[model samples]
Target: MDVFEAIKSRRTTNGYFLDKPLSDEHIKILLQSASYAPSHFNSQPWRFVLIRDKARREHLGKIAGRSMREVMAKGNFWKRYLKYFRFSKEETDKSGDGIHIDNMPAVLKPFIKYLFSEKGGEMMNKLRVPYLLAIDSKKLVSRSPLILGVLLTKDEYKKDDLSGMYSLLALGMAIENIWLAATALGIGVQFISLPMEAGGAYWQECIDMVQPPENYELIALFRFGYIDPNAKRPTIDWSSTQRKPVSEFCYEETFGNKWIPKE
Candidate 1:
């Protein structure tokens, strides 16, 4: 498949065929594509956990649902405050003595809405697809820091202190590769960052199940299966949403100077 076509057509699958399963060969191909994604200094920090057990997937779905509900119930107070302040700033700043105080909600409202929506819970439940792929990484650096030499010793890389931004970028590229492969194979795939909240626990359990490096962190999770033909697909606005023109995004030697013609 053409790379650009695959990228343009790839969409997150919500309704998956419950009984359909991807063959081992196809899964292997998808993983191989992901493995070839670019990494910084050849320090491939990503790992994958494939969950195929139905009972385990169902348990995870329930746990995710409960977590969603708990987060929503507890988060409403702040959500309401932010919503009120965002739409009614004058009312938000009113005081008993007519002295308007700056009582604006400090947090971003869109993030809160995402946390409280049913789509959030649905996204969690959808992780129960036929193949649940989880990616992990070492929390600490290795004895030899490959080509980068960014680390002095294994102890130098702390999960909290060490920056994994490049590692994450690589992982994202890998995920995109998998998505494109799945699209070509007529398979459904969805990526979830939900497991991040339970990453510590998940990695602890994984460590018990598999011999992992002394220090590692769970990075991402994915669900794969067949698309449900009967499901109602959500409509997407392709026209209004667009990438900024090259002129708007690129600049010359200095910032804000157009690098290309505006029109």
Candidate 2:
């Protein structure tokens, strides 16, 4: 399918058929598409670890399930139990630092709490699907104390923060390519961020099994397989979910100046 058609049709598939296995050839094509995604200075920083082993997938599911439950339980009681939880001095000290978190207002604490406490668990459990794909970044791309230091220039350090953003956007593009391919092939796929329970150590163990290039770091994971044809998809308002008019999002050299021109 063409790019626009793929973009319009792609949807997240959570429920998958465990019995159906994707062919090696199909998997190859999907990876090939991902590998070609554009990156900063043509630095192909992303690596994918495809997990086809049923036993390992099951283990991941169990860990994710438990992690989800814990997060949900904490969310349900966090407000009432706020007094019992201690806020670290380090966290408070870093609040005013010129980093991304510096702009966060103290009033948003409850909202942040709700974000971490509530949806965090649901997002974790969403990882328990059929095939798990672990995405990693090359170590060379992120070896310094500052995560995006490798890509930042001395002159552009404070002004531009596009290095890491570009890498992630490229990775996201790769993911979209794979997801669309899966859709066309009648396969189901879900993108999931790693749960706190399956943190660095656990992920490192899984990555070691794949034996990727020495410079890679785990980035994201995906669960995929085939879905039952008879299953009903959740109803969504297409207009709300679909992209806004290009005129609304796009502009000329200056902000709000129409580039497309009034037709």
Which candidate ranks first by TM-score, i.e. highest?
1
lDDT tens readout by residue for model 2, 1-263: 77778767776553334355667877887778777777677765566766666565655555444443453444443334343332333443333221111222344344443433435444423542111112111111111111100111222222256666777776777777777776776666654433433455545554454555544445555666666677432211011123335676689899989767567
Candidate 2 residue 143 C-alpha distance from true site, Å? 36
lDDT per residue for candidate 1 within 108-174, as digits (tens), equals: 2334234334344343234321111111111000100110101111232344654356666666787
Where model 2 places Cα greater than 4 Å from the true spot, the runs are 76-163, 194-214, 232-242, 257-263
lDDT of 2: 0.47
Candidate 1: list runs displaced more than 4 Å. Answer: 76-163, 195-213, 233-248, 258-263
lDDT value, residue 73 of candidate 1: 39
TM-score for each of the candidates: 0.58, 0.57
| lDDT for each candidate structure | 0.46, 0.47
Identify the leading candidate in terms of lDDT: 2
